[model samples]
Target: MSDWTPAEMPRLDDATVVVTGANSGLGYEGTREFARRGATVVMACRSVERAETAAAELRESTSATLELDVRECDLASLDSVETFADGLAADYDGVDVLCNNAGVMAIPRGETEDGFETQFGVNHLGHFALTGRLFPLLVAADGIDGDARVVTQSSGAHETGEMDFSDLNWERSYGKWKAYGRSKLANLLFAYELQRRLDAADDDLGVRSVACHPGYADTNLQLRTAAESGNPLLKLGMRAANAVLGQDAATGAEPMLYAATADVDGGAYVEPGGLMNMRGHPTVGRSNDASYDRDDARRLWEYSTEATSVEFPL
Candidate 1:
């Protein structure tokens, strides 16, 4: 089959989508696209003001005939995630699509509110707990809507990741990039393992799990990282390289939009089509062998359950 594009997405009338980090970057663009397709998009962001601003901008730009709801969710804190999920559950009986797209790139060594390494905690475990908490609503939605999807945002950096469970918190040593890679890898593994559990459950719940990576995209994430590090030279180099190679956030969101709404089978890992899966249109991409290790995935799931105290019913 040919590669999927944003235009291929089905009309999303009556659909309810919750997107983490919908206030900016690819997540914001994805929210706009979904709203343009008639889906009621919920912006689960850390900042309510930013979320409202983004929703206003989207409303002005599109005439897709859908409403937007903006809410607060700081994934770094489990309490915040719980409050966000609880609020969503109280407001909506079901959710058609959940896009776990919020994440931090390389940042200076720091711990999350929960005392875990910042990147891994926010990028992986945060979404993991969020999904688990919202799963009941998702299952209910699938029962009512016929199908539901959960799309986790991973990255190309996962190829270089190794799950150092012994040092997941980086108590002994810390490298920002490596921790980010590990968290992204955790995302992929979590997606696959979630699919497995869902399939094994054999319930009528038609909830499917998938993963996607935005290739080199021009977004605030890169700029913020560089600014925080005070690396003007690296930032200049990135800008020069981006001019030559980086894709826009709209294009970067394609893989995620595809994974969220396409007719493709569950458990698929999607990415861009250009050189080294770095840029271009969306396509099915290869994940590293380590990412496919069922045993490790299961272990990670168990560890996450213990860490977050949120269990997947499957």
Candidate 2:
């Protein structure tokens, strides 16, 4: 656990990693780095065609030693998540890293395939269920500095989140931006709570659940959200903002990459080491006060278990 940055990240010669939304944006950037460092990356994406195209593009630019495999796993569908987890467990020896990087932003209010709110369902519960389903593998992964890592990518937007347990599905009212905030906050809560459980578990398995946020870097997330939001102004504004103020997507992936490979402890929050956490190299940072509320985390965990029907290995 020495002081290290993304440039000092250790290579993963024989590690196997699973990254959702690996077809583009932060997920792809992280996957590219992992693959470049000689890890076998399983690209979990919703569309096989897009995943293949992205993988091929990476292969073209990446070192020939890199290995990338694409698999279909749509977070909006619990059934699909279950199938993906089952397939991963059967095919891989153990997962060294599980990057819950796939998520939607402030898109239009909608429901997932399972009738849950789109943001909460895909961004939080989907990853929640996926992580729970893969808990055994994470526990069994071969340890380098410690055990396997469950790196959940959260966001600064969490500062604005207030988890509304009563109307999680947004049956009463739906606010796209607020829902996005809630999802990011849930990512932090789940990561911290999972770490607590891991620390308390009696088993020798020493898995770590860590959280990280790429401070605002330019990614297609904003554009996608705006496009789907059906707000012409939002779409124009985001595109303009990204063009003018955003950093590169690869740079945006630095914090997450550091979190995945650094000598960090469970519950650590990695943020860009720069002014206002907007952009810079990956380094440790602070989360908002609401993120540390244990009572709320517990309640959220319970509700997540009931909602997803996938309980953690507590």
Candidate 3:
């Protein structure tokens, strides 16, 4: 449906949903709706204090009986991801949805705790390791209700992304935006490849891997990037552009909600359906040609497993 909204989101009662970056932006918006709809939302965030504040607000605003689990999960650190997964596994037998929604945008060139490019590490490899570590819980959820979903949040910037396997860390040279794009591209590759692996496996696990992007959403990411760049003019220009062209974070979260809950097939790419797929209701869409490259996906998967020291159960 072209005009889908969160109000129409199906009841997620009796589900356990994990959302990374749940402290703010699109993750916060999605968490609100999920909690309102009775799903136990795990707020996996970088800051426990901020997440606790967000959980309090979400509880007060949504339902008195809303269930929220705030956990510390810093995507920049592999050990943190593992710890988060271990905690989830210890408490929950299965998880119905895992939203790989945490990411860093066009920030200055930096390295994650694992010594990888910040964007590539946080945006792609972090999620890769998290997904693999949580694979058992997802598989155990196979017959709990219906297909469990892994909703990965990418970006339109992925269209311009190019994978340079030779130097994914950007050691020789660094372009912040380029690295961001490449990381987003890797998100799509991982989403599609996960679906393919699931389908080809001996057992039908009923875990759908769908990717979606929030087009031009007015979130703090742009502001933070501009502020971190130490460019006043860029900050002013970005503020103006966001005010003019960006949609609110809640509106931008529709595609992710749709991909996570709608009757979409595995590997579907959900995005906004307005002018140039920028801002509107959620709709199934297509990504770029390069994103569908199987060779690159395979290479990325291999390198990611080696880098993160995590393996998919496929």
Candidate closest to the true structure, highest lDDT:
3
Candidate 3, pairs of clashing residues: none
Please provide TM-scores, in order, for all candidate models, with all chains considered together: 0.96, 0.97, 0.98
Residue-by-residue lDDT tens digits, candidate 2, 136-161: 88888894476899999999999999
Q: Please write out the lDDT profile of model 1 over residues 1-314, one tens digit for every residue.
A: 33667888888887889999998999999998898888888899989999998888888886555488999999899999999999999999889999999999988888889987889999999999999999998988852136789999999999888998788888999888888899999999999999989888867578989899999998888877777678899788767777777899999999999888876677899889877888888888678999999988999999999999998888
Off-target runs (Cα >4 Å) in candidate 2 are 1-5
Instruction: Give the runs in model 3 whose Cα sits over 4 Å from its true position.
Output: 142-145
Return the TM-score for candidate 3, rounded to 2 decimals.
0.98
Q: What are the candidates' C-alpha RMSDs? A: 1.6, 1.8, 1.2
The best candidate in terms of TM-score: 3
- Steric clash pairs (candidate 1): none
lDDT of each: 0.88, 0.89, 0.92
Query: On residues 199-278, what C-alpha lDDT tens digit does candidate 3 reach at each position?
Result: 99998887989999999999888998999899999999999999999999999988999998888999999999998999
Give the runs in model 1 whose Cα sits over 4 Å from its true position: 1-3, 143-145
